[model samples]
Target: MAAPPLLHRHFSNSLSSPPLHRHFTSSLSFPSPSMRPAALEPNLFISPKPSLNLSKTFASVSFENQRRKPTSFAPASHASDSEPESRENRVGEAREAVAEYLQKYGASREEANCVSSNCPSYLSMLIDGVDDLDGWNSLAAAAENVEFKRKVSQMAEQKGDKGVLPFLESIGLSLASASRLARYFSPSKSNALPRLIHKIQARRGGLHLLGSENASFGYLIESFPRLLVLPLESCVKPIVLFLEVVGVPKECIRNIILLFPPVLTYDIDTDIKPRLRSFEKIGVKDTDLGKMLVKYPWILSASILENLEKILDFFDEEKVPRSCSSQAIKSWPHILGCSVSKMKLIVEELSKMDIKSKKLGHVIATSPQLLLRKPQELLQVVSFFKELGMDEDAIARTLGRCPEIFAANIDKTLDKKLEFLSNIGISKANIPRVVRKYPELFVCDVDRALLPRMRYLIEIGLSKKDVGFMVRRFSPLLGYSVDEVLRPKLEFLVKTMGRPVRDVVDYPRYFSYSLEKKIKPRYWVLKSRNIDFSLKEMLGKNDEEFADVYIGDGEVLVPPS
Candidate 1:
């Protein structure tokens, strides 16, 4: 037990403050009156009574008293009058005396032996000697020693009992020591180590054993998110082993942190292309495919999309397009079997479609497996639309415009048509009419024409689809095929004999001309005339003159005189 803190006492002559006076009074114990007024007080105090009697009394007693006690006090006075030793010299003598005593008996042979035996070198030697049978015996003796036990207990009390863990480990102690230290540090057996393991096991559904390498420990820390508080680098193996005992659940795992660089390899399946033709039947969505491209970005291969069609078909078969209930959506995961994140993204993309396709959303949300497959098929759909000259936005708008077409049966038909049209080269210009005239044709001729020129229209701030649609509508009035009417203009240079025509067949001029005269081909011509008269004749004989003429094509066209 610790002692109580000491209290300080203060004495002051002036007490103007009541609190100060009370504080002093409560703390101090003064002597009573009976103890006062001793003979020493007269010498100590310069009171009037003591001062007046001092000289008279001293003079009267001095001579006689001096004579009577002179011989008796001489030896004692002589001794007292001798020179006093310096404080430094006295201290030195004291030290010398203490040294002499210590040399003689302060430390006995037994005590010296004890100190020597416990010296670091001696202990190290003793430890070495205990190697084999002798070493075991010595270790046992140390373990059993009362003094050693007391020292260990004291060390534990000063520092936590956990301090013993490292010490025991350093000496290659047995599991018993580990257990003992653990118990001492955490008697309840609910320590961070065990708890971390439990948490990891609960989250990931697997245990990770620690490896001997430092990297192994790092892996353990990454794998077991809860064990972040430990000095992981020091004893990674133990930490890893502990993590291995505790399993991690799959659902709780969000992201994995890696210590080593990852290596990825891709294997292409040649058979996937034919399989992808049936993507819509399998429940794959263009949006889901688009998301996959965004997510992996690098894995956006045509082959992968083709393989994904099978998965999409599975989703399509199981999907309930009419149901918007949460239960229906929830049932998707059971049918499709995919992770939550994938399922969520798939559902979100599906929900953006018209309500008629709500069943697709429900199916995607419930089925993780379908969600996975949906991404590739989605990419394929987008590719198909793009090949037909439809941008992502255009495809989305078209899908949004016609929600009733996304039913499971209709979806398959649309997929087949898209494939057929894509193979045959249909233009996007014909899509709206085709879609409207033969909504049932979604199952047979889904492909639209590739209107690359429309992109230019869109770039100039016009909606590409709107431009294409308008061009298609006015094709007959324009007296040309929609492709020709919608064809973008090209720039070229033309050389002419005269001034350039600002406008071809100006309506105002043509109308006025028509009103005035019979219609006839109007021609403009430039003629040249040659004069026989020489320039010299104008300048007079002997003073020759020359003339020059230049044509537009950098050619000289002067007529000879």
Candidate 2:
């Protein structure tokens, strides 16, 4: 094969010279004075040398020559007046100069003029810094920047599409990126560049696939410009449809692609669908797939039986219930991508702290994300709770109830929860009791969950001290929503049941009862029978036990069918 284009070789040599002046004078010159040199005239092509202004350089030389001697060829009166005519002659000479140079290198008159008009900078880049020309085509292959030439040449070499180089450059692809993308595929495909460019234009609408945030579109393209060349129907569409079908919103699609562009290359049937099926088979619900993808889009492309099955099988071996298995893994599918050995390491770390298999499984089922976090981090959280005076057994229990506390900011969440309790007069000594009794309290938002319920209790006539004592006694009250649970039940107790404010303060556990199942039915039955029951009697007993004790051979009236 002939060596690649000399234009590339010549330009590379020229650009490597020490200074701007050396690029033109040292690397390039005219064959004869009759053939006007392109270097002395900037109009032939835009000079690549930033500092060498062609007209100024030539004019200064002309001025020095004029000072050295009077012109013998021109009459004395017209010598100075000939300057304007000389400039016009240079402009006329520029077009002929460009044409003659390109023609000498095998371009026809039309090709020469077209090349000059369209890419004026390209010829200067081609020959300005070049040296030691071998032949008419020598400049074509003389570029030291082989990578860029190879990229542009690959497109031009394709049958019927010599315009591909300029076409590609016209798009946003930089020459460096084009060269890199050229190497991303095989060299034998002479038609690859045209096909790639055609594919990009064919799927031009894919730009809109990045959704309302066009900013990510730039990022996605810049990150993986080659993705534009992927087969729209065969490659990109299947992955897009799979994600959309799985509930990844359109707005999130760009971010997913940005995070994992190789996902587009995954074989939809063999790679993507199977992994998706494995996720579903492992118990990740379709509804939760969106959440999973948002957090770890790479999971969609993870090896199914290799990665996901290892997690599911491990959970099975740990006796994670079949019912809870899907919920657990869906809670954090990113952990499914973690090496099983790393998961075992996490489990082993937890076990060292006395949180063993069953407890570990339960904690994982509730917060499988725990498997994503480092075992060391979890241990630190455990130590933090321990520093708060909780023993191993208490921490283990707290993990079972609120595994997310291990993931939360202990400084913010744990301190805030303790601080709220302290403010409510629960005392520093009693915080562990509150946490041990209700670990969920540490995870609940203090502004949203804790304050409103306590305030509602005071509104219903319990003193602040009495409400604080009730919370310390039954810490679960911190988990109930005031608008949903506490307020309605208190209204019923005060109005419907005619229970005095004093009675509720005395037995504040009344807030913990299921208002629908226990409070409403039992209270209705007792009230209808014209019998009175204390809050404790009504709430403490199961239905059968309450009926056996309170009804006393009279038919235990059931909740009205």
Candidate 3:
């Protein structure tokens, strides 16, 4: 429903490709058409960038590091029985075998011949490397209906004239995918007219419920092309309806499905609810579970319960409360799937950094994502701060305050924010001060969020040097919205309060207080009493302290409506 990510039309171009369902590679590789079926097994999670790009720039994840192991369970699918023809072809035999395999698997002779003639290489690619029947059965199981085998047989009998090929071509599936999928429809591989009719029925019914026909359906279909003929009530509706029942909005169903189509394969009672309960037990409110799943749908699809228990044990061993890890997982559900051994490496690295074991749980809870970061990446932040005059405790505080900075590659976020500061006249020596003041500064977008605020301040009569000092003093001023926070507050200070804008150079924290709530009421309180106060002296005091000091304790002054 969010724009499709790579859609993997590239699946048809290369035989080594992962077909339609494999995870995106470092290069954002999508499965080619030939690979989609074999890809459906083993590789269960696909990290599509469109919906789940969630903040790649949060820190530095070398895109290479982003490539997850395909979580292979079956033997690998690359064709290896290379004969002298370059695993190429002996003219007749491979085609015969491919056509035979297609028919044995349910493709009719006519349909198989049509597919074999069109995509000989794609068909031939299967026989050598994969256990085609085993792979085909797995595809059959994905449809999950009692009628699946009978459906496959019926599809196999369709003559070339009546097959589902035209419907597939119209849907924009690649030729290899169409050819492979045409036979694979045990509801999965065939191309009967019934299958096309069912696809239309699904598009109008269940898929229409998912929100977009043009964009999301195309991506979803590519992942599980067989989903067309799957029993709507048992296979499709249950998953979509269960998401709604679990508090996922009707609109968001496609996002979870598009990110990991295997969520469709997971059984509602055994698989889906158990995973949902795992998070529920961890203190995830029922309302928040849908959001967490949307953020990381793999939470349901991946074999996470075993690893989740291991992580809970890790948290307990570290003396962190189970509740603490719950908060961590809410922020980063992917951590639920991380191995404890991999986590231990990170803990040991932090331990060597003089980070106390007592603080590990809280630190991770504050930024659950840090557990996924390589210790080297964490050290990258430490090494950077060490170079910047922060000691171990200082580095811990900086990273603990903005743990996202822990993985920020020196080449990107950390470096870019620092460069943005420099461009706005923040000196190199003063950057650590700015970071210490607001470590969240490292994560703000340089051009979009940070720079415009700085430019607005400088535009409003503060010299660039004044802003440099103010930012070094209160760097979060850069993070505030200009339309909402910056412009209105500056207007009040100079035009309404009649204070020099230079007063803000002395107290950038002026932007930190609410305008109508604190600033306006307090300023009018002081003004009615005919008293003057500096920006800091007026706004910095606690309400009782300010009242006791400025407004008499018993005095009732309604400042404004």
Candidate 4:
């Protein structure tokens, strides 16, 4: 089994505050510690930053325009004096109102049930408001392109004389755009026409003004005409408020709405909160969740149980350590949306290379995006390595060390990196051995990483032949950076120890050692006793072995201040 998380121990010992898990809050209102659940929901916590006043931002919604007469189904003329109406009676009345409205609109029974099933949220909006049917008109009349615009403009003016007509004209929506809303928001059926007008008012004054030339209101309305009819407070405001509360800037909300309009329709309590809680439980932190939502807003509408949780359950069943699983998911939340069948196919493909059970789970934990790659793409990466002379066993071993090779852009990226090595004079025959030893080199930039490091080696007095031999022996040197890794170690050896460049060039593997912990401390310990040692003699031993051999009868030098 893998060792326990170092993070948990480090956090507990170093910090006086509570654990990060406890610091998280539900996407609902911020609650105190006592009010929080025993195990807090994942990723739902608010930031430590001051909260924004979302109520003020959303206060302009005008519900008054939606007011109308009661339902067409009047109450029974002769009521029993003994019995009062109950919840069932209200539901029945609401159902009748929906049935009558659907009938008037010439909807088939199948169509009505399908529509009602798609929007379970409609019952709540229709509860008390179903009584008002005064605004209902003929579908054909309401769909008249000219009449719809004039009526919408009049409704817009009734609220505060906002003049939606001139605003629309100024913004210049094509006729197809106006015609789409006219057909979808007909006054002849439900109260959708008036509600559509109210929703537009909510968008004004915010950055998403219908009058703004840059606004995409025409595209959004044309794409999801039904969105205009959703109740502002019950259906739309909760989502907008939740997103704002989670720190999505107001300007980005319009783009999110346009991209994933169903976010406005998903039930805040039943659909959204539960899915977010599930994501949190899987170890996606609050900050990660917020960023993921803003980037891939469609995640809000994706099936949580089927897509996200199933993949996590697979990891748990395979005994991938929780911390590794958590970090991987946090890094790539979109992996959560990959279908279980696709993941199974990937696992099966990896099995072809003899990676199964615990090792498979471990590989996934290290680089979960491997599960997101197309099986064909993964096969191509394996094929490329095999074509370069690595057998399946060698490829599998290399993959164990750096499974992120699965994410490489094989045809383009690997080719470019190999071309760089060829240009640098590393013979083609030596390339496979170097690559097998350091597969991660394929994932790096040749210009930024490989060439610069090679240039520094030649500058330091190693011949091109010697440099190529060093890389063939220890391929990882090319992966090190000139400024951070190679240069600092070389500078320390030359300036501090007075070692000549020739001595350092003999063992390029010295660049791989930790300078402060291994090189500096060990050098000073040997120097204290006037003993000289090879690079292998000084650093090749394990810690306890080195301590016994070097500090046998003398005090080791303290680390320099």
Candidate 5:
């Protein structure tokens, strides 16, 4: 191919001066093709030295005379030479200047053409003696103008993918600009948490995009505490994913709120259970569930409980069940143990049900006391049992040896066993059995040890029949045979009044007799309606005294004292 046109010959000459000049001289038979005198003939080189000196002296005098002359003096004289430029003409000249300048910087004609057509005024100003740095700085000042950004983006697109970063950089876009563009292009989802999480995971510094006003995004960002003020939700998944992907320790995630959307009901028959089980597979614990429950109490809606019931039903329906209803029941205690309000709600709800809901009812019943106790106390009990590492059956058997602990003062006796319990690592649940089997151990007054056991019994809220059976079991430990302990008077008092013998034993003889007599009439009236008119009349006459003695609403009568 023939030699290419020397479009950037000046810069090329400066770059490859020595070799190119030599090549040009040898190939073209020219002393200096590029350096030839401007508009001079070949004969000028033939002049003698003295003639050349005289001509140079004359030329110098002429240049000095021209410099002294005023340009306005010749304005009308050289009408053809002076271009009459209007405002439009001036703008055209400016455009030409810019085009020439851009050409010198290696901008192709097509690229310059596109810029000129899109922003003629800007292009004109850009090339009017402005350096590359000044031109770009001016452009940057107008960067926020939608029209300017669009044109720049179009130019970059024309150059294809490789030009994107360079074009943006030339316009003063740093990493932050690229991110802003990305955000503008990809507006976050309605619930931006998942999208923000993905971005944070994909980009090392992506979390910085989260801002305080964008709380949803901020929540996710906060998941990475080292990165301040990120939305907790935005950071949550990434933190979770980081824990999963890189095996970060759970302790590192201490401050994050592990929120479960309130919409997620726990029905195993539905999608919720599988999702929960999946979370469990990834190391989420009952403790985690408990924490979520505590933090978002509203999540425990009726629907959630219904879903949990559905889960139980699913287990019941399965041939080889993955979960037992009983096991599911056991899990509820921890959830119910969250707060008094939650416990009360759970109990009230469960109490109204007549199905096979003992597990739920039991959990609800125990939860109030469990929550009321200090966490440290509960932890102590848990730790003690955990340290022993004995199986439940073994612990139950050991407890069977202590019956006196279950007697009238069962609540009082548990205090004495605390030391024993601590030494053996026995659990609190097992203490009741020990108290029932070995009542003698409960000989001590009600104290710390006894309180836990009493609380446990109260928590169970057993029916009268079950309570009687339990109380009778303590007979031998109380130094009485099982039959003697089951005497009619004791049984009647316990079953009917729900009071143990200890209360009657402590009462003064006169008071006890008075209460018994005062209560006897009402009890008889309730039992038999066939009592004569005369007896009814007498009972009515004593109604005020009966109210005073039994209901504490009126003055007691004293006649002929």
Candidate 6:
């Protein structure tokens, strides 16, 4: 009922500002080594701000456009007596300052440190005041999203003459991007593009659409420059209206166009509607049309639909069930974007590796993105596992169990996960067994997912050694959450069920049972009957088995109404 803590209030206020706009061209470079953020959401408890390096938190610009870094994007502080610290050194010092400051303001030390180290610029923004405090908070949010920062930073770093295509300049496209468009679209050695550009500007929906409220105009133009040349009435507007008629939400029109601007180039009767019909034929229910269009608007694109048919034909040839393929498309609509030629190569490679043809359909359904991966990348993942002493058959078994391992990147995905396992006390020797058993563990996030669960386990009373053994016994134990699954179940086990925490160590699978349905209902039945049961015995039973063992032997007593 009470208002949240000051840090939470401040974060909420700063995170709700106007989205980034054009005309914010400034260069910024930070030398901090990347560190992952500890908590997705900062702790809401109140605490004093840390005063470490109180000398320099507010040295950058105040919360405004052009944002946390100043207009010049210079170092946070300067020197009068001696040379200023190296850029890396300054980032390091600021990271320490922000991490400590965040901890004092209710973030756990892990959360603060991870955030501080990952992007010191974000932490620097907390102290560096931007100009327009009321409207520029999303700059802080941008610091958290690496992709958003890349886009914004790309716009901000544009260095061009002010005299470039004034029409696009007026509507937020960077001059560099506009110039590229002019050169690329104009094959003739003539000044006709500038004239064509102004003509499009004067057209009914051309410039107006680019400048429309809520359009991601810069990103759209950068991604698909041909939108600048496409006619407003004949090409673009009809498609926009067609989407609304087809049940894509009115609000989603801008996003659909931005994602697949070439949709404007497709013929409605020949290309667009036919693809929509193909989608319907494949069991994409009428109700899911809007959601699918928004997620992968290119599902209806001309080139993608061509590939979609090829992939679907390949599925039929491979003995894949029609129902499974249909569901796979429904779940991951972008699988339509994959090349069927590459898929054939992957199937051959998989066969040589002993991957079963029977399991391939289900793998395709579960890991649709795997079809998009290069064959060399799959080999790299296989080689990494082979180094772990797994034979090709064992590797195929692991893939059949969790195909996501093959879909993942070996260096970026698997190696980092292996490091996280090592950091958490998984021995180098036993990691292969754990990997084969719980291959999903490689897909888990090190900073956000795995570390937090392990830290909570230690916080609740499990020693590091106890957790290591527990995770080996039931590899999925780390996948359980501290707040949702682990904490509530542990409380019930110790306080309500009167069982030792050692029971969890002995039977880590106890976390897998649903608390409300299986665990609590069965435990209550046992309590009413005055019978003691081990966690494994209590949880590891089917309904009929459980009823026969306990309820069949004794009536579960009912309280008087």
Largest TM-score belongs to which candidate? 3
- lDDT per residue for candidate 6 within 173-252, as digits (tens), equals 34344455434333231333233333333332353443353234444454554444445567766877788887888777
Q: Which portions of model 6 show Cα errors greater than 4 Å?
A: 1-238, 244-252, 265-271, 525-533, 540-561
Clashes of each: 48, 14, 18, 8, 32, 8
Give the per-residue lDDT digits (tens) of candidate 3, residues 464-525: 78877888788788788999998999889888999888998888899998898889988998
Predictions ranked by lDDT, top down?
Answer: 3, 6, 2, 4, 5, 1
Model 6: residue 252 alpha-carbon error in angstroms: 4.7
Which lDDT tens digits does candidate 4 get at residues 102-137? 433443444333322222223333432322322345
Error of 6 at 226 (Å): 6.0
Q: In candidate 5, which residue ranges exceed 4 Å CA deviation?
A: 1-223, 226-292, 295-434, 437-503, 506-561
Per-residue error for 554 in candidate 4, Å, reads 9.1
TM-score of every candidate relative to the true structure: 0.18, 0.59, 0.64, 0.58, 0.20, 0.61
lDDT of 3 at 218: 42
Instruction: Give candidate 4's root-mean-square deviation (CA, Å).
Output: 18.7
After superposing candidate 2, which stretches have Cα over 4 Å from the reference? 1-205, 231-238, 280-291, 302-305, 312-326, 458-464, 500-503, 525-533, 541-550, 554-561
lDDT of 5 by residue, 302-375 (tens): 43343444433433443213333333334332232133333344234323332124443233223323322343
Q: List the candidates ranked by TM-score, beginning with the highest.
A: 3, 6, 2, 4, 5, 1
- lDDT at residue 162 of model 2 (Cα atoms): 32
Error of 1 at 259 (Å): 40
Between prediction 2 and prediction 4, the one with superior TM-score is 2
Which segments of model 3 are wrong by more than 4 Å?
A: 1-206, 214-222, 225-229, 265-271, 513-533, 536-561
Model 2 CA lDDT for position 440: 84
